[model samples]
Each structure stands twice: as structure tokens, then as C-alpha cells.
Target: MNLTQSEIDLDLGAVTMSCTTDEVATVFAGLLREMRSAAPFIRPDERDALRQIMSHESGALTAGEVFPDFARGSDAHTTLRKLRTAQFIRPAGRDCWDTGEHIEIRPFARIVWDRLGEAGVFGDPPELEEDDIDLALPGADEPVEVALPAPAKARGTRSGAKWDEGDVLDFLNDEDTQG
Candidate 1:
């Protein structure tokens, strides 16, 4: 079944998840895990932005090498502002925001697109009748939304703290052992 935003919100609340830093961090870590599973490693800037994106559940495209889209802001601040107003993400630091429990990148984007399509953001499509074979297609007729790549900001270019592919893999596997 297609889960609506309201339904997602209710589910998050019911599950007792916090809309705070630790909660956001955990969710981001999870998304990173997914990315890592698919690839050797994620770029440092991408990791940071992905954390923000996942935390805020911002439907706005994320800027980075991995997920690129035209709908996102040119800078991190502007992106944060838009995300904050929408209540999708909250500020966690000077450059970070807590994505409320309700947001998940893929699912949230689908919901946003569905809502926007309903609101006529992209204009209307031809009406489909019951007999139209296209109506039974696996995916929705609406266009899939993609997160825009993050602009080449100075912060992203800064070196030293960036984690490479191997570093990320090691970090993920590192489970602190108690003596």
C-alpha cells in the first residue's frame, strides 16, 4: 500500500523515535550502511550531505557526486532553509539538520512527487480510463524525482577530514570491543 506522509508521521511517533541529533545520526548511519553495501565507499562531502538529507527527509535533491538532481539549492545554507521551513529537516549544527522521524529519502520523495502531481505542480496528464492498459503499469505515471547534486562548496573541498572508501569500510566494521 502507498503510505502517506501523515501515516509515516504517525508510525514514527508510535515507534518512539526521537526527532533529535542522535536519532538523526542513527538514521544517517543506516543510509550510509546502505550506500556502502552498494559501493566500496562514499565521498566525504557526500556522506555529510547524505546525513543531512536523510535526517531532514528533504525532498529537495541532495547535492553530491552520488545523487544529482536540478531541484536542490546551490548552497548548503539555502538548502537547509528550505528544508527547515518544510518541517522535513531541523538544524542540528551550523551546517546540519535533524530529519524528523517522518522522513526517508526514497519514500519521502515519492510522497512529495505524488502530492505535487496532485497539486498540478507539473501540470496535468491525459486522463486514464479504466480500460487503459497503461493504468495497470507497475510504477506510477508520474515522473520519478531525483535529488540534485550538491554544488562545489568550499567546505566540500577542504581536505584532511575526508574519509576514503577503505576508511569508510573500516569505520563501518569497527565495533568497539570492551576489555
Candidate 2:
């Protein structure tokens, strides 16, 4: 019947292995907040590249795959190194950071993902083949169209009720009742 603030608070970090939506959202919110505060220090070119990565459904790619477009000549390598060092865009491999390995967007990068998703970040979904589409359950080829009964006009009444305002006059006007 009663609870303290600590009791109401959920310890998401303790059970991250469970991977619940609430826990994930909490993590994302924290990351977004940190990213916002750090935005002032983050370079414009790095920001553009990060936005592209977050928008990508795969959410990752090798430096070779993403570079050249985002970073213009000489300073590109230096900029990328800075980003990697700062952990803004991280390396996929534990041993090394290179063209062969992917640089993934952080799991909490949902802000960028949502923004890009709304702006057409992902391509159209793959079309299903005719055989792949299942219209109904097994052994049921055609969908059963259910026709609902017409709505009753009477207010404050339902079907199967012993008394209905709609039929009150009929009961009152019965010959036996009148007699």
C-alpha cells in the first residue's frame, strides 16, 4: 500500500542482461544527454558522419566504407582518429581499429537513429515473393469476413437484458396488461 522513492526506482544497470525496453531507453536517454552537452566540442564534419552512421539500419561500417564522403582530404584521417579516441564512433574489434573492422554507432544512439529514420535513413523493405505471403492460417486459404450485427438504436440498453426502453411501450400496451 505504501512505498519509498528508492523502492519505486528500478535498478536497470543491475539487470542489463535482461535487455528490457525500459532499461534500454534509460541508457539511450543518458547517452543522448551526454552527446548534447558534448556537441559544442564535436566538430561539424564528425557530427555529419555520426548522423549518417546512426541512420544506417546496420548501424555500422568499416572506416573505408564511410570515409572519403564525410571527410575531405588531409585532415580526414586526423579527424577520424580524434573521433575514435574520444569514443564517439568506436571500433568494432577489440584488438585493432582499421578499415577491415566496422565502426559501430553506440547502442544509445537512438536520437540520431530516430531522426534519420524519419528522414528516410533506411531503404525500402525487401519485397516478399508471392509464395512467401501467407494470407491466413494453415489449411485456411481465404480470409473469413465477419459481418457484425447492426447496432441497436436504444440508449442505455443491451441485447439479452430483461428490460429495454425500446420494448417498454410494447409490454405496457399488451391487451392482458391493459385489462
Candidate 3:
């Protein structure tokens, strides 16, 4: 298949198999890098907050540790809400969020992370614990939209039965078989 310039730039691997162009792939890698770079030393409250976000979508998180005033501040609450709306996270259950849920990291977020990873933006993997996620907020009423990479151009030959060298060979071969 003839690849367009955009496709070429994106570095789509082979024609077969599910693959994303390099451009969008890089984006997802970047997000992962960012997550890794953030020191795992997030405040105990922050860890709890993240866990809560993860739990809501996946339906249940192991309970053990206690989080302090992670959800006390208005800004923190607002930020959590926004993140949930963006589909970056969601409330898990009774005061806990699930971070590992597939939906938490939207396709767009994945693309961003991929891009960042290509750029080598992450320093080291973060040592996050289970309590990093918190899930206290009520579920969001609106649906979250995760943007996908632009569709690839359709692949095919040019219009009209133009006679190329290969076409001529095949035509002759067919004629010989008929004779």
C-alpha cells in the first residue's frame, strides 16, 4: 500500500496488523513517561486520592491504608473532578479511585504518553503504592470523550486501468494459459 506523507512521518509499521502512526504513538509514550517521572514520594493523601479515582471505574479497591485531608481542599476536589471529566480518572467506590482501569487513561492520554516516551522524558519509574488513588466524589453525569488519532487515508491504486509493466505481464500470462 502506498503510504501518504503523514503516514510515513507517523512511521506506521507494516500495512497489516493494528498500528498507530508514530505521531500519535509518541503522545501515549509521553504520558507514561510523565507518570514514571513523578516521584513516587507523592504525599500519602495524594496516593489515596489517585486510588479513589481508579476504584470507581473498575468497581472495588482493596482497603487498608487511611488517607488524611486529601479531598479537603476545594482546588484538590476541583482538580479531581476535572480529571474525571477528562476520562483521565474516575471514582472507584466508597472513597477510592482505580488508576489501573483501562478507561482511566483515555486514548488521547495514551498517545500523549507515547509521544513523551519517544522523547525520553521520563527519568525513572515511579514507586507508586495502592493508596495513591482516592475515590470519594460522586460519579460524573456526563460521558467522557477520548479522542482518537486521525483516520488513515484509504489505500488503493490510481483511477482507470492504466497499463503498467506488471499489468502487461499478467495479461500476457493469462493469454498464454487460455491458448
Candidate 4:
């Protein structure tokens, strides 16, 4: 008889078992634990933005990295702040891997991807017997509705404690802003 995931009884009468993995998986598992606890509290777009970031090769990425020509302003600020507060993602330093030092990005994508997968959002994937069974928070069983907000029009960047888009010196090297 084929039993469904939720229906399977985990009684395991007299047998004992444990799950094991290397350092990376261990770290991932830790974050997954926190996320599972907080999943019920996570916002929709916040999850989407994080999931998009996680779907990338590197777990960390700026909102600009996720959305081209957008995500560099207030929306980015709000989304980043929300995820950070939820403890879903943490500062992984600047976007030094590619653009180098424009914005700070977070790393927690892979965990979120694995999270969405287990929700069956990706639909009926095969699972090995050794996988950890997650009794996720009830509301998490549904897919998060992602309503991506529009990017802010007036772009003003903050560097250090002060807000400055570009120095007059940096502008001198460019055309439109140049004399």
C-alpha cells in the first residue's frame, strides 16, 4: 500500500535512526530550522525575493542583482529589511563577486529553494529515505503569493553614514553629468 507523505506513521517501534551531513549541509540545516519556525510569519514578496536569490548559484545577491533596472531603491530597502528582520537572510557583505561594492547582499537562497521544494511547490519530486521529515507550519503548505512592488523612481544612494549618489569627481568621468 502506497502511503502519502503526511499519512506515513513514523512510529519506528524499536529502531533508532539519525540524519547526518557535512559542514555545509549542517549550516544549511540550521538555517532551515530557523526558517521552518518562521515560515508562518514570512511575508509573500519577501519570500519571493529571497527564493529568487536562492535560485541563483551563489546564495547571496542584491535586489539589483535579482531585478535588472529595478530593486535599487525603497523597494529593495523594504524587502531587505523585512527578510533580515525575519532572520531569513543575513548580510553576506557587498556585491563584490560581480559589480563590487555597490550594495550589500544576503546569503540564504539555497535553503529557501530547498524549502520551496519540500512544500511540493516544484511538484512530486523524488525523496530519499534519509531525508529529514519537516512538519512545517500549517499555512506554509500553500504557495506564497508574490506581488513584486514597483521600484522607486527617484534613486538616491547612501554610502557610509551619508547619502550621496555620485561625487562630482566621479561624475566628471561620465558624459551626461559632465560639463
Query: Per-prediction TM-score, please?
Result: 0.21, 0.40, 0.28, 0.35
Instruction: Give the candidate order by descending TM-score.
Output: 2, 4, 3, 1
Runs of candidate 4 exceeding 4 Å displacement: 1-30, 67-73, 94-112, 115-179
Writing each residue's lDDT as its tens digit, candidate 4 over 33-57 gives 7656656655676667766755655
Question: Which residue runs does candidate 2 get wrong by more than 4 Å?
Answer: 1-29, 69-74, 81-88, 115-179
Give lDDT: candidate 3, residue 64: 22
Cα RMSDs, all models: 25.3, 17.0, 23.8, 22.2
Which is the leading candidate under lDDT? 2
Among all candidates shown, the one with the greatest TM-score: 2
Which of the predicted structures, 1 or 3, would earn the higher TM-score when compared with the native?
3
Clashes of 2: 0
Relative to the true structure, how large is the alpha-carbon lDDT of every model?
0.41, 0.54, 0.44, 0.49
| lDDT by residue (tens digit), candidate 2, 99-136 | 55577655445545566351222232565797797565
- Per-residue lDDT tens digits of candidate 3, residues 1-179? 22454353333466444344565457655655555455243444554555463444333332222233234345455545545443444454444332332224344434433454412323434646887854536656555553221121112333343445655566567668779
Better of 2 and 4 by lDDT: 2
Score candidate 3 by TM-score against the native.
0.28
